[model samples]
Target: MNDPAIAVDGLTKQFRGGTRALDGLSLRVSRGGIYALLGPNGAGKTTLIRILATLLRPDGGTALVAGHDVVAEAGRVRQLIGLAGQFAAVDDHLTGRENITMIGRLYGLTRRAATSRAAEILTRIGLDTAADRQVKTYSGGMRRRIDLAASLIGRPQVLFLDEPTTGVDPASRHDLWSLVRDLAADGTTVLLTTQYLDEADQLADRIAVIDHGRLLTEGTATELKDRTGAAVVELDLPPHQLDAAMTALQPLAPRRDRDRILLPAPDGPLTLRHAMGLLDQADLTPTDIALHGPTLDDVFLALTRHNTSRSARSTA
Candidate 1:
């Protein structure tokens, strides 16, 4: 098989306290696309990102970035990779332009070249108007944009973003999304670690879900959602009518949870009709109704629940 931009096999990491942070985690990311690494807190997402960025050493197994082994060719991997960690680590006193230029200089650019490159990147990130202002004076979004520009000083082949938009506002999040998409379109392979399911749904061509130090599943958003079966109809009936709705729905649908009525439906029209008909017969009136397909939430819940149950049974 041809080499992927990033690949890992049996990757394991144990911290100083002997806690297993990553256990046999393996993943593959093809070239020139966006791949979202998803997991809840303490699921080894950050550990894996640190290992891939050469910031932390894995105790066992191997990881490759841009076809270079992370252990043996750590320097080479660093040369071809750009990493933006979860925190915005920009020097607060430094202007946005100065920050990016400093990064360019660190990457071996001459003073003049670094200045020019910083200007170009600042413009690209839409921070040109604020380029000369101290980063401390910028909003959270501006700081993040500057940090992103700093990471791209050398136009790296592989970029690793660890929760890049964690504290950003909605508008800033949208800007970051556009920037990431443009980067992928320009053929930069992007690996993004995010807990936000909607971020993965909108940006990633494929997503890998991990939890409890293990990789659970990976596929396109739609493909992963499909694993859970079909669309769900959630009926928020009044508290008093909940029992009636549940009873009426359970017989006609695949599942019902509390006040929610879930049906394995291909489309909404027919399912809506049947559900309304049943409600009428049962003399039920719901306060709210929602139609939801197999969403990222469903996918995450299904995979993690399966893994948790399996682990529980094994320990028993």
Candidate 2:
């Protein structure tokens, strides 16, 4: 089998104030696939990314990027990876082309090579038309694409994106997503941290959810959803009928909120039909009814809920 593009084993880190940022985290990412890290704020996603990118040292264990130890072969690892952080890092005073050229030069390209590469990247990222405009004049999404273009100056084998689309408009975000897919298709392994669950659902070949410095779960989106083991049947009824609908759906252990009742539907359509029949028998008509498979949002909520519950119990 081929070596993983990135690997972590029992990785750990802690801050000066005793905040444990990572606790025995372990995972492997294969070559040519997008691996997304999902977590709430301060879940150590950034810390882990920084460590893997060789920007910060881990307190314990080890991390390898492209088969080189991050700590020992920091220089080699730097050469193998590209990092586009949460914020665009381009100099606002420089034009988009100049910014990319400067990065290429910094990566040790000749002046001519840097200029050529910069033009190539600007064209690739669809910023050629605005390439000569100062970064400050670019829209939020344009800045992001330019920053990403700079990261590719060295044509890295592995790329790390930290919240790559946090505040971009929807259209730009879609474009960035397409760019990422194209990069992975061309065999640049990607590791990204995202707050948007749907982004991870759409882009990641595999996802790892983390909370409180620990890995909560990891799997392909479908596999993670399957782990929830039941679809959700949502019923929208008149507010006055909520109580009656809840009682009728009692066997499914329905949860109620406002005018909607949500219940597990292990048998999917069969269970949905039974639920509607029960409501019919009770002379309660639903305004709307839908059956939805478990979503990434559901998986995230369940895993994070477990973390919260466990923390509360430990504190108690």
Candidate 3:
């Protein structure tokens, strides 16, 4: 295949003190698409992102972003990409407009051009009215919007978002997703790192799961879920009979909570019916029961668990 918007081959990072932050991680993100790098904390997702952003050097392998080698063409790579890290990058002392303008100037835009571009970007991000407001006074969502605008000041071809919506409200998070979709639609490739599986499900055209500095798997949401081959069944048992309920649903039980039992139901409708019938036979009626397709959360848990077991044995 042609070179992807972002490509890495055996990229690795070994920090001082022998900390292996990245272990031969490989990934490919198609052009004009949104690729999500997802993993729990300490999984090297951030480290990989730092490497891609050219903030950290890798000890082995290579990373080419937007067809520019991250090491050999670091400056060119910087010109082609924008990064909005976990913390809002807006300076509290500066107004939203000033923040954008400052970044535009830093990118070498003329003063007049930077001002104009900053105005346009503020308007685009729905912050024109608050453009003159100090970032310290802006709400979390507003600051985030301003931060996003700053990243776009140079009109970079690729954008990197690291947990962009970690602390935003639900409504704001949804709004950000819409903005990201719009950017991708406009042909800007986005590589986002997030711990939220739902965020990946909603925004990612494809996802790469990383754990313990290694790439566990990468595929479209449906593709990854399909690999699991396990349908999820959620059942709510009567509060008092929850303990006994697990016994009756033993065949379908993979996990149990206070009043819910989770299990695999690969056969879908037929399997669900059989499970319900079995519960009925035991004279236990569920208040709620639902069947769901495989989710990214399931895939992450399954793959990471398997990897963990293998890693432990190898160490032994």
User: For each candidate, how many residue pairs have backbone atoms clashing (under 3 Å)?
Assistant: 0, 0, 0
Give model 2's TM-score versus the native structure. Answer: 0.88
Q: lDDT tens string, model 1, 1-316?
A: 3679999999988887666778898889999989999987888999998999898999999999988999899999989988886745579999998888888888899999999999999989999999999999999788778888988987989999998898899999999999999999999999999979999999999999998778898999988998877677777777788777877876555455665656655667678778878898998987887787878877787688678777754322
Which structure is stronger by lDDT: 1 or 2? 2
* Least well predicted 10-residue stretch by lDDT in candidate 1: 307-316
Best model per lDDT:
2
Highest-scoring model, TM-score: 3
| Residue pairs clashing, model 2 | none
- Better by TM-score, candidate 3 or 2: 3
Which prediction has more favorable TM-score, 1 or 3? 3
TM-score of each: 0.86, 0.88, 0.90
Full candidate order by lDDT, most accurate first: 2, 3, 1
Q: Compose the digit string of candidate 3's lDDT tens values, residues 277-310.
A: 8888888988998999888888998888778877
Backbone clashes in model 1, listed as residue pairs: none
Model 1, position 75: C-alpha lDDT score: 92
